[model samples]
Target: MFQDEARFGRMVRIRRCWAPKPARPMVGNGYEREFLYVYGAVSSLQGQFDWMITHIMNTTHMSEFLAQVSSAHRRDFIVMVVDGASSHKAHDLVVPENMRLLRLPPYSPELNPQEHVWDELREKEFPNRVFNDLESVRRQLEDGLPRLAANRASIRSLTAWPWIVSINLNAH
Candidate 1:
C-alpha cells in the first residue's frame, strides 16, 4: 500500500467551474487557517483504501493509523510505501507486526498512488467550496471518505499505474 497524509482546511482552493452563458460564477473564499490531517493508504492491485481523519499529524497518530490498518488486514503482510515524514521515522513510532514501512525518495510525491486519491477527494468533495467552520470541513471529509472507499473499481482505475499492476502480477 502507498501511504500519505494531507491537510484539508477552511482555506478555499479556487478552481474553474461552469457558469451558464456569460454569467460569471462566484465562489466563496476564506482565509481561515484551521485544518485537519488525513492519513491515507491505498493498495493499487486490490483497490483497497484505508484512511483516518485526525486533529494533528505526529508519531502517535501515525502509529495509531498503522495499527488500524494492520488490524484490518490481519491475514496479509503489508509493506506500506510512505514518504520521509518525521512522524513516519520517529524513534518511538510503533510499527505493527504484520506491516513494514518503505520510504519513497525525497521530493517524489508523484510516485505515490495515494496522492491521486487525495486529488480525487479535493476535486469531488471540495471543489469551489468554502466551509464556515472547521467542523464543517470535518463533516465533509467524514461523509466523503467512506463514499470514496466503497468504490473499489474507481479506486483501482484511479491508482493502478502500469508499473504497480505489473509488479503485483509479477509477485504472484
Candidate 2:
C-alpha cells in the first residue's frame, strides 16, 4: 500500500512525510522537533515551497524534502531487486560520493520498502483526505512527521492489506 502520484490535468497528489529537523542542533538540552504528513502537490512555483513528492525518482526539485537509502554493510544487503524504473537506470542522477545502483525485480512494487512509505504517509499518518492549498497541506504533513517516524511499525504496516485499501484500488 505504497503511495503513488498520478498526473491529473495540472494537479498532482504528492503523498509525503514532513520531518524537517535542523541538520545540526544543540546537543542534549531541550530542543523542539516537529513532524508532518502532507498530501497534494505544488500547483505553482510558490506552492513548491509548501509541498513535495516523497521518495520520487525525479532529479529536479527539493533535495531537502527527500533522502536516499543505502546499506553500510554490503554483506547484509544481499537482496538484489530489479525495479525497472527509468530513474533507477538514469545515468544523469548524482548520487553520493560513491553509490551503486541495483535493479529490482521487474514490476515488483510489492517488495519495495518505499511502497510502504507512501502507503503509510497517506493512510496511518493521513486518513482519507485532500488539501485545499499547498500551505495547508504542508502544515498538516509537517505536524504528522514526528509521530509517523516514532512508530516505525505503523509505516511498515502500510504493506499489509487492511491499511492498504487505497493502494490496491487501481490494481484491478
Candidate 3:
C-alpha cells in the first residue's frame, strides 16, 4: 500500500481490463513474484520508547510473526497494529499462540506506516537492484536490516507494524 502499485494492479485487472477472448500472449516464465512486507513502527511524534518485532516477509511467515508480535506488545502503549494481509486471519501461520491479531481492513494501506518505510528502503537504498539469485536478494535484505536498526526513527517506523519488533522481546 506504500506506493499503491499492487493494489492498483488488482483494481485494473478487476475493472479496467476484463477478460473476453481466449486468444492471449504469454509473458515470460511467469515466475516473477513480489514478496512484499516489512517490519515498521509508528512513534508518538517525539520518538522515545519504541515497539519492535521480527517483520513478516511472506504470507507463510506473516501469520506467525503477527501472532508473536501481538502477544508481546499487547500491553504496551503502542499496541496499535496496522496490516493488510488476507492471511493474517485466514492462515494460522500469521497467528501465534496467545496473541491477538488485527487487520487493517480491505483497501486500507494508508494506515500502515511500515509500507512507507519499506518503499523508501527499497527505492532509495536498493536502487537499480539486481541479484544473482534468491539467496543474493535474501542476503541483501538481511544486511539492510541491521543497518536499518541503527536509525531509531526508521527502526521505530519499521517495527510499528504488528508482527515485527515485539516478537523479538518475546524471544528474550
* Candidate 1's TM-score: 0.96
How well is each residue in 1-172 modelled by candidate 3, as lDDT tens digits? Answer: 1111111000111112234698553322223343434444444232322222333445665544444455545654333454554544454454444444455667777666655555555654454454444455556556665565457775455445664434543322
Which digits, one per residue and each the tens of the lDDT, describe model 2 over residues 48-129? 1122434233543212222222222222222222256454355654443323345656777665544445554556544424
- The order of the candidates by TM-score, greatest first, is 1, 3, 2
lDDT of each: 0.94, 0.37, 0.44
Regions more than 4 Å wrong, model 1: 168-172
In model 2, which range of ten residues has the least summed lDDT? 41-50
The candidate with the higher TM-score, 1 or 2, is: 1
Name the runs in model 2 displaced over 4 angstroms.
1-57, 61-82, 153-172
Clashes of each: 0, 21, 22
Error of 2 at 169 (Å): 35
Preferred candidate (TM-score higher): 2 or 3 = 3
Score residue 163 of candidate 2 by CA lDDT.
Answer: 36
- Cα lDDT of candidate 3 equals 0.44
TM-score of every candidate relative to the true structure: 0.96, 0.45, 0.51
lDDT of 1 by residue, 1-172 (tens): 9999999999999988888998998888899999999999999988999999999999999999999999999999899999999999999999999898999999999999999999999999999889999999999999999999999999999999999888742234
Question: Which structure among the candidates has the greatest lDDT?
Answer: 1
Q: Candidate 1: how large is its RMSD? A: 1.5
